[model samples]
Target: MIKFESENVQKFAEACVDANSIDELLAGFNHLEADATDCKTWGITPAEWMDAIKAATAEKIRIWASENECPELLKAIAIWKNCPLEEVEIGGEGDIAAGNKWLDDDGLITFYRWNAATYGEAK
Candidate 1:
């Protein structure tokens, strides 16, 4: 049976990936599974697995977003100020090139300016 109220659902899911039946799964951490492939012992279903995956992914996104308080654009600006990039022209005919660096281009940290086509990933 799935250890209900377990916060380490992702770890459990990972361990159970190769299990042919619930018997191979853990009751907790110490207890081994019985030889019998009892369906009742399997607490999680395919649907529940999907749900768990979705929840885990969403939670990761939330955590990542929270941790990345400094946006890419700001980081690029800081790079420009701290470590000056090599002679990469500030602008080309009022063109926007390096601005896209925050998302795609490698010029984000090194380049001084860009012919901004759009506001980059950072504000």
Candidate 2:
């Protein structure tokens, strides 16, 4: 489970995880914006809030991939994050090296891979 120092950020992150669409996530952010003073009191800046949200979203994706036994997706995430496969904590039976080799051989450019790379490093 992901943990945040700020309670407001923690609640916001949970709301983000339950959100069904971008609009819902935006609404949650708006709610947080309304409580900016409370966030500041907890020493959380807007940037940190965004970072926590991203981390929570990434974790949700990671959990989905793990539960679905989708190692390819996990590999794509790791590749995009530029993180070593072993560090991703992907709980499955897939061979990480072979998956990496296949991804390289296929020269795949998926949304997850592209977007993950486009964004900052994984948390």
Candidate 3:
């Protein structure tokens, strides 16, 4: 196990909550690891780090499900829970895409969609 500051751990937790991608979470964790302490008492293993990230993601999903209208967030919850997006319980009569867009007027759906539009699809 590697050691780090308790403050690093707290910052890691906060970053995980806001991380919308695996890359972002790992980047934050790596940055924190650079300043770790020299004793086991403050060190955390990679597995523990991954577990913290998962917990943060789950907590975010729970909060989003309870208080958000964006279907993308709902879909994130559904995917996190391993359930069908259709069964995630959004209060709307429209299809998933429509409901998503209804709430935000621009639900990008996935990273692929964002990249596609941002960079243009290949011919």
lDDT of all the models against the reference?
0.33, 0.49, 0.43
Model 1 compared with the native: what TM-score? 0.28
Best by TM-score: 2
Candidate order by decreasing lDDT: 2, 3, 1
Would you estimate the TM-scores of all the predictions?
A: 0.28, 0.44, 0.32
Q: lDDT by residue for model 2 over 15-114, one digit each (tens)?
A: 6667644334334444545346534654567777665555454545444444554556556556665767665444442222323343221122233335
- Candidate 3 on 20-111: residue-level lDDT in tens? 55334435444545323322433555555654554454344334334545656555535544566776554333223322232221222232
Q: Rank the candidates by TM-score, best first.
A: 2, 3, 1
Clashing pairs in 2: none
Q: What lDDT tens digits, residue by residue, belong to model 1 across residues 1-123?
A: 124354444554444433322222212211323222321244554444544333333233223223443446345444554533431222312111323332212232123123122344323
- Residue 107 displacement (Å), model 1: 28
Question: At residue 27, what lDDT does model 1 achieve?
Answer: 26
- Give the 10-residue window scoring lowest on summed lDDT in candidate 1: 21-30
TM-score of 2: 0.44
